[model samples]
Target: MKYSLASGLQPPFTQRESFVRSHPDLYWRNKGIAAYEQNRATDAITAFRRAARYADKPSQAMIAQMLWVGDGVPMDRVMGYVWADLAAERGYPAFIATREKFWHELDRDEQRQAVVVGQAVFDEYGDEVAKKREDKALLLARRQITGSRTGHVGALIVSLRLPNGDFETVDGALYYADKYWKPEQYWEWQDSLFEKLPEGKVEVGPLQMPPKR
Candidate 1:
């Protein structure tokens, strides 16, 4: 099933904005996409890296593509391979294919370099480290919104204004914790937002180089 934070009528506008602010990974991903669409390759790469802190796979793959081709940054096949490998960690078929493509293109020395550099890259942006960052942000956002560190409001009803301007009441504790606070659930939900790839040759490279600034 597709995941979406806003799948249903979400919380109040202010709460939604606060949640977005807390999740810098999502914010940076959106920023990177916007900059990339505007042909600001340097800015897009920068934002993508920021998103990589939380193990945003799409951003990680984008970084790999850009770095491999020397689009915005200097071409570094080793680093590109490193990013692609990280993006493949969740066993996504598209990402795994991309990682393998990068591996096949590397020479012995570059392959060795990728292994060495990959250790450092994983130390910083791999799932183990990055997921912790997301968990912390999730906890903080939950606390801020619920005014409860445990996210337990105990039968309190919270009124949420939908996008259609209709207000609905929901169980405050369950709504905040299950829907937004729990890290694993939240990540799973967010992951659903990614577009489903058709079964075929997944394009592993950038479509076109961004215009040189």
Candidate 2:
């Protein structure tokens, strides 16, 4: 593991926003979103393009749509297709459908060019994209999100039900715990396994927002 964090309550979104701003990759993403929502298509495209350099998926998808329709940016169908295809590969399912829809919409040359361009983007940006995910996970771990709680395995304690972007486990995460921790710290029903502490449970569905301050 290249990352770890101390267990503690997460900072509020206001603070989180400040933290994210230091990361150009994530900061430009917010800028693009704000620009797009305000109907500043050109600025949105500009921000998205910069964000794309960090392999930001939403920015890639947004730029793809803008280019495909010539909304804020000039129509560069091939480049649009390239970004769309790249976003699709990164887990945005909608872009895959959009790219397919464009199959007959684009000429043979454009189609071929997009494929080549998309491949190039993939080869170049794959590592950066992966790094972004890792960074995000590390951030979440450091914050110890509000919904998160502690767990135990004998003497080994851990955080349970970590957010999806970080830990995908239903059980819990030992993400920031001591390296030598083990499940045998306490007497266990199963000698080979650890389990959630009886008091621990997580809301896996949409959150019920706290009454506004």
Which candidate ranks first by lDDT, i.e. highest?
A: 1
Q: What tens-digit string does per-residue lDDT give for candidate 1 at 86-113?
A: 9878766566677888899999999998
TM-score for candidate 2, please give it: 0.52
Q: Give all candidates' CA lDDT scores.
A: 0.74, 0.52
lDDT of 2 by residue, 1-213 (tens): 111111124323312443355345557777877787787888887887777676566577677777877875788888877777776553323444555665667899998887777777777555455445435543454344323344232332333333344523222243333221222221121111212223444222211111211
Clashing residue pairs, candidate 2?
Answer: 154-185, 154-186, 155-185, 155-186
- Predicted structure 1: lDDT: 0.74
TM-scores, in order shown? 0.73, 0.52
Evaluated at residue 47, the lDDT of candidate 2 is 89
